[model samples]
Target: MKQKVIVQLVDTLDLGGTERMSVNLANTFQEQGWESHLVVSRQSGGLQNYLNPEVQVHFLEKKSFKDLKAFWRLSKLTRKIKPDYIHAHSTSIYWAVLLKMLVGSFKLIWHDHFGLSDQLEENKRSEMVILSKWIDRFIVVNHKLLDYWQKLLPYRKNSIVYLSNFPYLKLNESIQKLPQFTFLNLANYRPQKDQLTLIESCKILDNEGFDFRVLLVGQQVDSNWETQIKQKISEYSLQEKVRVNGPSEDVTSLLAEVHVGVLSSESEGLPVSLLEYGLAKLPVICTDVGNCAEVLKSGELGQLVKVKDPKLLAEAMKHSINNYEEEVGKAQQLNQYVLEEYGALKFFESYQKLVGAVK
Candidate 1:
């Protein structure tokens, strides 16, 4: 049997959920005895370090939306690689569509990591519809997205699939003890991430004399947003209670020190952070957004609160900490469920079957 060749395409290797998934898929493909290559249409960032050394990495260094040089370079590379399939993550589908037009033989699969769900604008939907004809398959992260796209392109229902994002960490249990009751929010500084709401919740915890700290970890995607978060921390006198740490590659080590994991995003497409939290076996407290409720089994496995409500978030956080033993036991059960349902082995197996059926 011939080994399948796959090229995973993405805008960059930034510390975002989509970027991490692209890297994870590429690595998994290589590990599963496939010819795996990763191409970054734009420049690379910190997440590049996490990529498997066996997978080839290419950077086009795209300077603008219409950089003909970058386009030519990607086209040339695609021609040389001659992959059996080009798996495009997020907006990289635009470039993959162009490459398909130029090359004409390899399959093009678009992995939709669109965070807005049903809130997508008219122009974006129109653009996606126009491009849907060229795509051979559409891989969605959740059923909601699958349903939305299925209804949008009724004729293309057979081509769309719902593939959950799997946990990609290799954890080593640490014997070291954590200093304080710590909660981690593992998302980049963005408006949609709603870290400000997390800060407000921290203020509430502090006012009630809770001895805990919340750590915000990820790249500062927006400098203005980071400044606003800092201002809120200062205004609320939460300098000690809240800490904003930039992106770190050592997530497993960080996970070992935290007591709880939290995601306060306003929107999501089945957040990878939630999976990481499960993998780390930390009790999760997340806002009711995206597929979070589904991932938490409607709060049976974790705690879910209303978005933008600091009081509710604080109350949930307090409840989780107060019932740490019981909550952690439930989190441990969730960890096993995640490993069974979204493990790397299962993800790779599904992709193999999907790609086999593409032709």
Candidate 2:
């Protein structure tokens, strides 16, 4: 049989778990001998640098979903590639929905990479509910999302499934070294990330004379959110302890020096950062939301704290420090678990089987 061609569609090549997952799957499939292609609906960003050279990239530079010119452009590309499946991630599903209508050849696989699965009702997209019926299949990054989408598209219950977000291993070491016990957060500045809670935790740690340092590493997506986080950092005089910065290509190397990995997001859907932390063998302190408790295996692998609770987060941070050796042991356990459970090969095999059965 001929090699199957798979195409991944996403809104951007930005630094987020969803975008990283798109790139991850594309790279994995291509490395596994499939003709994998990646399609970016709008502008491309730094994450594009991580893609495998074997994979082809197409940029639509779409102004809006209604941009007919871009739609036609994508339609033409679809005819040329005639892919067996178009796996669209997050917002890119909108375009995929349109493509399915226009071309009517490829299977539409819409992956729900929504972060606010904890608050799905409040943030429901009417357009998605209306258009979801067009999706040939659905993939969710977390179990909560699988539940949400199943309820929304009850007719497609059998078609929806949950898959874990695999890690994007950072191989190179960071150029600069942080303090021995510095905390690292690999998330973009978004409201859902709730960087404020982390700032408050930093303040609590500082006031309690805990002597800690936090390195915020990820893309600066929301200028407003960035301003708010930095304003809080400045107002609290946390300039010394909390270092809010932008994306770094050196995360794998940076993991070498950081004492722990942390996420304070009010909502998340199996963040890839946590998987990277586990793969890097770093102790974790994350807010209990989405599949985090499941990913960390209910504190068996890493520590899980209540969401939006700075005091509790601060306490967890303190505990990690006070029992550094124990946390390290847990980190080692997490490393083995991530390797066994969230390896890229497993994801590729699962997706290959799914695609093979789709027809």
Using TM-score, give the best candidate's number: 1
lDDT (10s digit) by residue, model 2, range 1-359:
88889888989888878888988888888988889999898889878889899999999889987899998989999999999899998888877887898898998898888888888889877677788778877888888888887887788788888878898675544444465579999999989899899999889888888877899988887899999999999999999888887887656677877889999999998999999999888999998998899878999999999988999999999999899899999999999999889999988778766666675
Residue 123 Cα positional deviation in candidate 2, in Å, after optimal superposition: 2.6
lDDT of 2 at 263: 95
- lDDT measured at residue 39 in model 1 versus the true structure, 0 to 100: 92
The true-versus-predicted C-alpha distance at residue 80 of model 2, in Å, is 0.9
**lDDT of model number 2:** 0.87
C-alpha lDDT of all candidate models, in order:
0.89, 0.87
- CA error at residue 73 for candidate 2, angstroms: 1.6
Candidate 1 least-lDDT 10 residues: 117-126
